[model samples]
Target: MNSPAFRIRYGFEAPECEPQLESLLAHRSVRRYSDQPVLPSLETTLKAAAQSASTSSNLQMWSAIQIERGEKRDRIADLCAKQRQVQTAPLFFAFLADHYRLASLAPDRAERLEFTEFYTMAVVDAALAAERMVCAAELAGLGICYIGELRSHPEKVREELNLPRGTFGLFGLCLGYPDPSRPADIKPRLPMNSVFFSDVYDADRGIGDYDERLSQFYREQNMGDATWTQRIQDRLGGPDMGPRASQLEDLRRTGFAKK
Candidate 1:
């Protein structure tokens, strides 16, 4: 898996490969899961891993809500645009960009949390923490998927989670044991030259041959006739990016990502 994953991800093999690199390259968003229950300890380990991630100014401006399996989880899944993975996963987490706790500690300066830069910092902090947890889960052989639909109906999600004014649901995470019958493929990414740069940024290092590569990959997976560029344009050009076009107002109302 290491050798193939590395080859597929980079379009070439590394001169030397380590087990950690293999684990990282092997990542695929797993949506289908088996009926096996997730160990309770796994949540603790993941949270610990998340806390270990670097935060902006050590502000720790992120929090998460784990939805236990039941009616609440089903409601959350429906809120996330009927994403079945959220409903079926053994563990579901709504990761939040939170300034509410910190603000409570100093009521007089709570207004500082309303700034756009602070909101951006919180969003980045939450994303970093969530990624660390995802890495830990993958290392432990647990399958995971990130659900961005949580932001689609920001006010509704806030009401459902009982979120405070200075906290916003940034995304959701689904965790479970992978159903081997429904395997996930490694999606192709842009070439290293296209994304990584030295010193000054290189804006012209386009997608290279990724379109063709991903087109074939999609066809092999029977995922319909959508190229990478087509998908990107369709998602970004339209107002319907999963009902999230008007979410900025919701964020402003919730005192997050405002400017």
Candidate 2:
């Protein structure tokens, strides 16, 4: 009971944890960073770790573009809703769901790239690879924040990155040494029973308990009184997805999800 991982993540008690479980449960998004740089050698190692992730049928339909500090980096940061971490992080990477490489390799048989299934596969591949890289970076004492706002202006990102027809800018990542002064705290999640169902789905297992816990967390973090349910409502209850509303059209233009 009162295991470190459970305490930090669920605000409850659980059995003891292994080191790897503790590491995974301790993840937090760090926006403020120290001036310490992530070395190029370490970057390579992290990339290798990403490459080690499993791919769909070994097609490996994903790629990452490192953006150094420059005009292009600043432009991309602006494109990602002008996030301060994006502009200032020591290492930035744009993870792409890329079908271009495979299509190019077999140009005559590239018809399948336009299907939604292929698009989904590419996105899954990119996510898996990026997660592997993130785990490796965290193990190396580096912190990261993911920028899903990269999809806000997909066309602009495509043009800026010189991406081909079958490559989509899925997301961006910011990595650096975390600033001690502005440390991030691990946020609580719903109870395991609420999510991990036994045999069949159980709608009766509501998130009322989690709402109370997350409300407390929000108050402690000075993040206002919005509970997780309220947050979800605010995000999804409206049709105003801003520029992301054009995502389907953008994806089609980029030769994905056409089916």
Candidate 3:
């Protein structure tokens, strides 16, 4: 059987690109999932893949909890802005920025963990691990969606998971066998030249071309057309980040982001 032809779904062709690399370009967020359950051994391998991600100086300041199906998952779904996928996906991983383990190892050096840089490292580490896991899952023909809404109610999430101090829920990942009946398209991204630059930064070029491309892509998906600039404006225009506006304070309360 012939492999599926790959193209830049944003309305361009990159036939010169190697076929193996093209699979990475074909990623799409799968919101709807079938009732199939991901096997326990597969999940173990996925976590191992995540753990293989690089960490800053090998600090490994990250952790994840696979929420089991039950009342806890239901509560967690509500905590994550009530995303139905969180409730129904075959697997859910609450990735955390964890400093607790390190602090516990050397309580005398705990003061060093209070710096903002440490907190940033933890968040970055968690993100790297999660993305690596996502890549592995996609390779295995599974679907995934990131739930950034897990940051909306940080304290509540801590309570739901019984998280200790020095651990913050960075985000959630929903994993499952995708429901083909409700397919999602590969969302367009900024063109390479616009994002990748040489030595010095060139701020002259704007995202006008990408905005137009994405606008057309949205229309093709039957969603109302809107420029990428407009979407960014809508998302970042105000300090009204709802419950997430208190993230700094929440992080502080969790023993991170301290002065």
- Candidate with maximal lDDT: 2
lDDT of 1 by residue, 1-259 (tens): 2377867776777666776667788899999999988777878998999999999999999999999889999999999989999999999999999999999999999888888999999999999999999999999998899999988888789889999899989999999889999999888788878898999998787988888888878898888868899999987898655667677887788776666
- The window of 10 residues in a row where model 2 has the poorest summed lDDT is 1-10
Give the candidate number with the greatest TM-score.
Answer: 2
C-alpha displacement of 112 in model 2, angstroms?
1.1
Give per-model CA RMSD: 1.6, 1.4, 2.1
Cα lDDT of model 3 overall? 0.87
How well is each residue in 140-228 modelled by candidate 3, as lDDT tens digits?
88999999999988888888889999999999999999998998787777877777889988898666478888888889888889888
- Which ranges in model 3 have alpha carbons more than 4 Å from their true place? 1-6
TM-score, each model?
Answer: 0.95, 0.96, 0.94
Q: How accurate is candidate 1 locally (lDDT)?
A: 0.89
Instruction: Give the whole-model CA lDDT for all candidates, comma-separated.
Output: 0.89, 0.91, 0.87
Overlapping backbone residue pairs in candidate 1 total 0
Which residue window of length 10 is worst by lDDT in model 1?
1-10
Count of clashes, each model: 0, 0, 0
